[model samples]
Target: MPSYKLTYFDGRALGEPIRMILTYMGLEFEDNRIDMESWTALQKEIKWGRIPVLEIDGKEMYQSRAIMRYLAKQAKLAGDNDWEAYEIDCAAGTVGDLIDLYRSMWKLSDEKTKEEWEKKLLDEFIPSFMKNWDEQAKNTGFLANGKLSWADLYLHGWVETLEVLMGKEIVNEYPNLKLGREKVHATPGIKEWLAKRPKTVY
Candidate 1:
């Protein structure tokens, strides 16, 4: 087995999905959580100076989605075939769009601008994505392929983050998405991981 070591801050954000994928694959790995001080010190040696870097057999890999996609294939969770993989990618990309929007909204300095962004997110972007995802999830209670895939896991992580940012349970408004998330949460390995994983505020 390849030795896996994941280096990230002591938070979920981008790192948790990678951890989830590893756990779901029944793979044991080093969870290297670092603080800002440690990250600053290590930044020079890290590719692209980013967290959530996964060291596989001591070879460093960067980019969270790339890592997740690679590991998903290892776990047999990517998809069954080329078309299914493409569908999964589409679903994952949609999730990525929401994440990027949230991050952009989060970085605003002006209170008015922040509030405007929040309003747009809460009233428009989130609802639109949630509605679409809820519709898509209705087919299988999973993001794609009518079965559990990495896209479902990606959606699970982002929904949690969205709930935190919105300060409420947003998924409840979309039953299919809610059911899909629950399905992901209830997976044997993931259920165990969720029970034992560190409680980070995100």
Candidate 2:
């Protein structure tokens, strides 16, 4: 078995899905959480000066989504076939779009403007995405292939982040999405990991 070592910040923002994928695969890995001081010291050696880098058998791999997809294939969670993989990618891409949109709010300098952007994100943008995803969940509980896939884990991680950003549980308002998130949380390996994983503010 390849030795796995994940290097990331102490939080879950962009690293949780990759961690979830590895944990769900029953893979033992070094959860190498680092602080800002450590990151600053290590930045010179890191590719692109960013993290959530996975060292597979000592070969480094960067990019969180790329790592998740690679591990998903090994976990048998990518999809059963090509078209299904395409669907999973579509969902993952949409989730990435939402994450980027949320993160962009932090770039605004003006407090009032940032507040306005956040309000719109919480009100219009999130609901729009939720409505569509809720429908998708209603049809296919797993979000893509009517079975568990990495896309579902990806969505679950995003939803967890959204809850932290919103300061409350919003998934309950979207029943199907709530159910779908529950399904992902209930998967055996994932359930165990959630129970044991270190708690973070996200």
Candidate 1, pairs of clashing residues: none
User: Worst ten-residue run, lDDT, model 2?
Assistant: 139-148
State in Å the error of residue 169, model 1: 1.2
True-vs-predicted CA distance for residue 7, candidate 2, Å: 1.1
RMSD for each of the candidates: 1.4, 1.3
Q: Mind giving the per-residue lDDT tens digits that candidate 1 earns over 124-150?
A: 999999898888888578878789899
Misplaced by over 4 Å in model 2 are none
Local distance difference test, candidate 2 = 0.86
lDDT of 2 by residue, 123-171 (tens): 8888898888888888556778788888888888767877897797778
Worst lDDT 10-window in candidate 1? 157-166
* Residue 63 local lDDT, model 2: 79
Tell me how candidate 1 scores on lDDT. 0.88
